[model samples]
Target: MTLSSSAERPSRCADAGKLEVSFEFFPPKSPESEVALWTSISRLLPLCPSFVSVTYGAGGTTRERTHQTVARLVRETDVPPAAHLTCVSATREEIDDVARAYWAEGVRHIVALRGDPPAGIGTHYEPHPGGYAYAADLVAGLKKVADFEISVAAYPEGHPENGSVDTDIEVLKRKVDAGATRAITQFFFDNDIYERYVERVRRAGINVPVVPGIAPVHSFKAIAGFAEKAGASVPSWLAQRFEGLENDAATRQLVAAAVAAEQVLDLVDRGVTDFHFYTMNRADLVYAACHMLGLRPKTDEAA
Candidate 1:
């Protein structure tokens, strides 16, 4: 699928109205980061996302912290919390216990993942012995414990470990068959990649929503590093746009906003109605993008 030139792009969706946007946040490490994260949450809560998700770190390093954050969201906020569960370094009983605990705490949404290897992204992933083999297995286990709404990860380019696109789609199908309600994609910068990926998934008879995950590039260097490991392509044009702007923080942020807004508007023009943002615990850039898409804070009257 070829992309249109920026000037040749169609008009924005006037009648599209506000999209159903959700955010994914990670568990913060320090007290300061914790405060910052909640502050970001408070800011985005008014946007009334369908739900907010907390990420489980590699090897389940942040399991307790992820639980703490999800539990707090359930206890304190009006938003629904989706806890990320992974099948790395955790036994079946332990993983099931976590799911049961989330159920007891009123969290009904789970993002099941075949987590990165304990050694990290580039390393080979050997599923823990006696543990769930992949996200599909974990999703199946969660369904038995409770009627939970499960979301699993989907890769547009392809999973890092998968042999091909057909294999990736088959893995996704397996997850859905195991009862996942939806599949959220890993972040990709190019809109065409996402559009074509969605088309392919639909053609494969997977009817569930494959929500595009949009990551607002906060730091060019940091995001580039992540993009390398996640199989998300970083276009040379994007690199050129950010070239030599490292010394200019304010200008870099403004450029980031414009780039992300264009990416989303392009998507909306292509008929996307749902979005999942990787907020990285920051609010302003995403807030601006959502505003451009016509999303607004819910007022008391509306509530």
Candidate 2:
């Protein structure tokens, strides 16, 4: 199926109403952060995302915390939680144990990844001798444990470690072959990059949904640092938007909302429906963007 550059908007079903959306949050590092995260979750829950995900830290550093957070969500909230499992620091047995525990706790979705190294994103990744070799391997292993709904990462620009676009697509295909049900891309600034990448993936014969991951820009410096390590390009135009708003929190928030809303709306206009928001454990900006996209609470009648 050849996708035209102009065919970027997601197809909508009149009977199904607006498009479905999801969110991603990381495990909190402190009590104050925990409070902040729950507050954010509460604010966005009314929008009724398809599911919410919590990120696992590098080298399994946040394994326990991630499990706790995901389990709590299953126990306390109406939202279905997707727990991220990575093949970085643990052996196959250990990784499987985490997946089993999540299943026991009623978590049916898993976001599998070849996580970052202990030293962080820029450092080279070296797989443990007895661990799952890559995310594809981990996905296969998880399938043996349970009939889990799996999602893997996709790179729009390209992965830092991959040789070329073909290699990247091949890796994605392998993940799907290993039982991944969907792919969520790394956060990107330009929608054109995402459109082209998705075209290539479909051309490669991978038929799963490749959901776009949208990161709401909260702090310019913080996001820039992340882009540097994650290999996501920060367009000059984006830099100009935040150029002089360092100390201007009020103005920066306004600009951030506008910039992110423009990106998602462009994606919507292009025919892309499903969005996975990297909420950064904050609600105001992401919530505002979702509202602009026509998302609303699921009232009792609708439910």
Candidate 3:
């Protein structure tokens, strides 16, 4: 039985077991994008994600936008919000003040990262003279500011700059030791790479949840470009699936839903329960994928 990319998802089973999911969104750059972000949130909210996270840009305008979106989540939504924080150009005092302000706003979770250099990815990363230096240092510093639940970045394929997976695991161990509560991976298309990475992580005695990040292919061209820079390999079959559909947006949406659902369902089969979706601030495909996984809009029994 061949499954069409857009075929209806398999029916949910009574004994399908339990699954949990979280979503990640970036700060919108414009009023139109902001509207799109909230619309996405409104759609996913009914599915009751474990917690939603907003991505932080290294500095300047994006940083402030991240704060505003996160603050609004705290004030307007019932779901817990996790704000991304990175150690890059800022001093320790500046980073600490941001953490403190989040605490003041009742935001309790952070995704701490040793961000790319101020020049962006592919450039040499230099720690600021007065900054926390790396992700581990930032994690420790945030812990000092408050007992915030922190998540750190992980890589299925070793990080582009790291020479080996062993070194990557070492960096993760340091972050975990410094009080990271969990690790969310850089998105990858291959589940086997993720499984092997998790095996290596557990072997190193790191026990916190290493959530798999799922990136739906909103645009093959865009995702392919980003994945290339991030060191994740885009499989040949995946490329073939999207090939020649460049001019067809409707077909692309169906293919995207099918691809994401297939990945998540396979993950559930592997006994993994928690998933982190890189929503890219759109809801339709992600929503359909969640529905395929048997998740439904949560109802308030009191209503």
For the record, the alpha-carbon RMSD of candidate 3 to the native fold, in angstroms, is 3.6
Encode model 3's per-residue lDDT on 1-303: one tens digit a residue: 975653232333422337788999999999999999999999998888989999887543378999999999999999999999998879999999999999999999999998876544448788889998889999999999999999999988888997477888999999999999999998998999999999999999999999999999999999999898888889999999998899999999899889998898888767688889999999988898888788888778822
Task: Give the per-residue lDDT digits (tens) of candidate 2, residues 58-177.
Answer: 999999999999999999988899999999989999999999999999999999999988864557888888999899999999999999999999988778776366787899999999
Query: lDDT for each of the candidates?
Result: 0.91, 0.90, 0.89
Model 3 misplaced regions, further than 4 Å: 1-17, 119-122, 301-303
| All-Cα superposition RMSD per candidate | 3.6, 4.5, 3.6
Q: Which stretches of candidate 2 lie over 4 Å from their true place?
A: 1-16, 120-122, 299-303
Model 1, span 1-303: residue lDDT tens: 997675554435444344689999999999999999999999999999999999999999999999999999998998999999999998999999999999999999999999987654558888899999999999999999999999999999998666366788989999999999999999999888888888889899999999999999899999999998887889999999899999999999999999889888888888788999999999999998888787889888997
**Models ranked on lDDT:** 1, 2, 3
